[model samples]
Target: MAIAEALLAASPQSACTAMIDFSGRVSKNPKLDIRAPGKLSLSHLLGWQGYRMLALLLSDVLALKMAWQIAAHFNQFYSPLPPELNWGSWLRLPSLFWLFAAATLLFFAYGGLYSSATQWKNYLRAGKLVSMVYLLSLVMGYFYDPKLDPPRSLFFTAWFGSVVLVIGFRLLTTLILRQFEQSQSPIPVFLIAPGDRLATLSHLLEQQLNFKGQSASHYQVVGAALATTAHTPTTVQTILASKAKEVLVENLPDTALASALYWQLRRHGITLRLLPSSVDMLHRRGLPEIFAGLPTLRVEPRFLSSLEYGLKRSIDVFGALVGVILLSPLFVAVAIASRLSSPGPIFFRQERMGLHGKVFHMWKFRTMVTEAEALQAQLEACNEIKGGVMFKIRHDPRITRFGRFLRSTSIDELPQLFNVLLGQMSLVGPRPLPLRDVERFDTWHHIRHQVLPGITGLWQVSGRSDIADFGDAVRLDLYYIDNWSLNLDLDILVETCRIVLFGKGAY
Candidate 1:
């Protein structure tokens, strides 16, 4: 088949779908699109990868210069320069040294030393490239200028110094960058394999690395699909919905299946990583290594690194503080309305489970009668949620006329910003469930306790009170935990705003 014909034949998608699901809801707006779907460019240097590259580059430059200085110092010790050539001149690099330094950097770049490739992060590569550059410079210098004869002491010392220093500097850079990588988010990955291999692939992808008594996985499986359904639009939608940066596929039934999925993901700027059945293909496409005693291909995702979790907390504090200040007027209005509509305090304080099952008082504008909790036993029969782990009533008798508007608009939750500022809650995360709700939670349901509870979350934006089953809500919470990212938080916040404005799912 012709090349174009082969590519066209492999792609199974009918057309590119412009719409993307933010949180179980479709968003057609391309502007607020919060996905980093495309490959990296100059702009990427502004992020985590860029910081790494810059560190390596600076290290290389320093290594090269230090090598030159060391070479000069050694030559001076053995064969002192004449009175005419001062110590400064003896230490200064000649034009020839500058030429060789330039060539060394060029060779390093050619060998992918400054790129995002993990294999090139080792000192061995840097040493090899430095040796090659020095050797090539020697051979070319001999040919270009036959009379160019430097002292043997200076020549060999510089050559050896260049290789050793470059390697040493790079190793140092790796140690420093490793500290930052430990705190960064795992690369979000989607798995595609036969049903039998799906679990194995997920386990491997989520394998944790131990560093300084702390363990963290480099990859997080956000979604998975059987290879049989890999080419379907539903699978494609699931991958996109998960906001996966890379899709890893293995043991495809046919080459076309892989090709088609690749094309579909490529269109959305998502990367397709392959684990070929044959050794030759694995070597060509990915880094082959022993994973869990099984030979496997390591296809690293090109992810940006930074102190994103710290940044998230910083944003939470700043946003919560600003929110309280700006919304104080609304707070007073709601307080007055609640006071006049019902005989109760303006703020309702309930004990809610927070991070690691710690109990804290979560504040909310009162949206029910003062006797609401006392009356809950009588309304259990009318509970709308199937599991009853959570108590919910679409239209409860306890809601006063003014409280209904507060509940519908989500104005009742504004007081929780205090919890956020107090460090008990976040601006975005799994919502904190009441102590009554926590008492009935299944073992797995408490996994949401691992992170700080939030004012809004995937559960609140996905279906809110519209969801009938608590299990489905817990599943969404799990998904949020697995696929958590700064962008995902922002997307949830945007979706929350839209939902609140329209009052789509709230009681």
Candidate 2:
């Protein structure tokens, strides 16, 4: 992560210095001789990201004032307070408020809230984060002056006002920037990937650009090189003629066209993107995952991913909270129905594997009759979804009529939101499987279990209910884990809603 920061920080001239002897090849590509105005430099790319961060940071500072100004105005309407009751100290940014603002900025920076790299920073997320920072400030201020006894009302007012202002500012800024981007030409990009996958990959990347706002309008892939083969002088010439300043490398072997060739281009101010086969797999980016130097991707896979992943964690916490709260009435109704409809338990707790093979008793609203486990062996002939190794049966007799409704409508999975809260699961990830299914797994299949299991995953969202092979299911799960991102999670969640409302649901 630190190395990645350094690469982004590297000066344009120094970082773009081509140590490798690319001069011979450059001569062959005469277009490379002419440095066009449209051609981007390293500093230009860095400037975009750096300035975006600055804009966000400035917005946060402005929001702090908006919050204080609201609090200050509210104080005017109230009766004159005695010295101790006065909550006006929060408005004094020179002393205690200074510390609060500094701490809040630090928290934002650490959380990647200030990063322009994040395209998913919407109002709800920004508001939630702002509320937390102010709440923390309330706690710290208590310690700062134990005798002052700050009014709880003032803290709450400040917290609420800050959330509204910050989110409003951010939303306005994003809309304006998005419009500016939509009006501009896209950044020229050169793509390199396997021929078989190129068209599909290209389409997905184009879609992802829409998500990237300004960056999306900025990226325009002008040419492509074969991933399976090394780049020759002719291929290099074709790339130069396209006037591309960004290179997207996917499925390209490092030995062939990736390492030296891509690295040289990067040094010459062409940005390098070590893309996954599926562009959606970009969610797998839990770190400062881009590399100005291609070799940096090899290091820091463990810790580098965690902080960015915390962004995903925040989504999980918020989604689970909303899901559980909104569904409480439904939860009760299902509990009553399950009990009256021949269920032994309102909620089912069965041991299942999770991240790194750790076992957790996963929770689900019971959707099968009493001792359904004992009756499974008798229903072998009715198995529907699984080819083998895992068990599933469409319209199984073990499920009561009410339970069947729960399964089909996916109401049964709502209780697992509690599991998501307990940190045993994510809102979207590989599906956790039963012990019997895990016992039958092949070696390569275990990789799916590396991430926290999800309530609905690629399998559920893809509407692959007719899949007879467990291996095929595992493949989807693995794909989700590998490409997992907060945006991807939200996409699956939206699709899960569509699938459930439309009649398809995970077994």
For each candidate in the order shown, give its overall lDDT on alpha carbons. Answer: 0.70, 0.61
Q: 1-507 in candidate 1: lDDT tens per residue? A: 121222234333432342122121222322221222443345346656668778887898889888878887888777864342233443566655566667877777655577534555867878988888877777886897777665678768877988888888888888888899777777677777766677766665555442343443666778876665575556788888887767777775442232224434643546566665622222344665543334556544333222356678889999999999999999998888888888989899999877666778999988888999999999999998987999998889999898899989999999999999998889999898888998888755765665567999999999999999999998788667645678889999999999999999987
Count: clashes, candidate 2: 6
The residue ranges of model 2 lying beyond 4 angstroms of the native Cα positions read 1-307, 505-507
The lDDT leader among the candidates is 1
Leading candidate by TM-score: 1
lDDT of 2 at 33: 13
* Model 2 lDDT at residue 264: 39
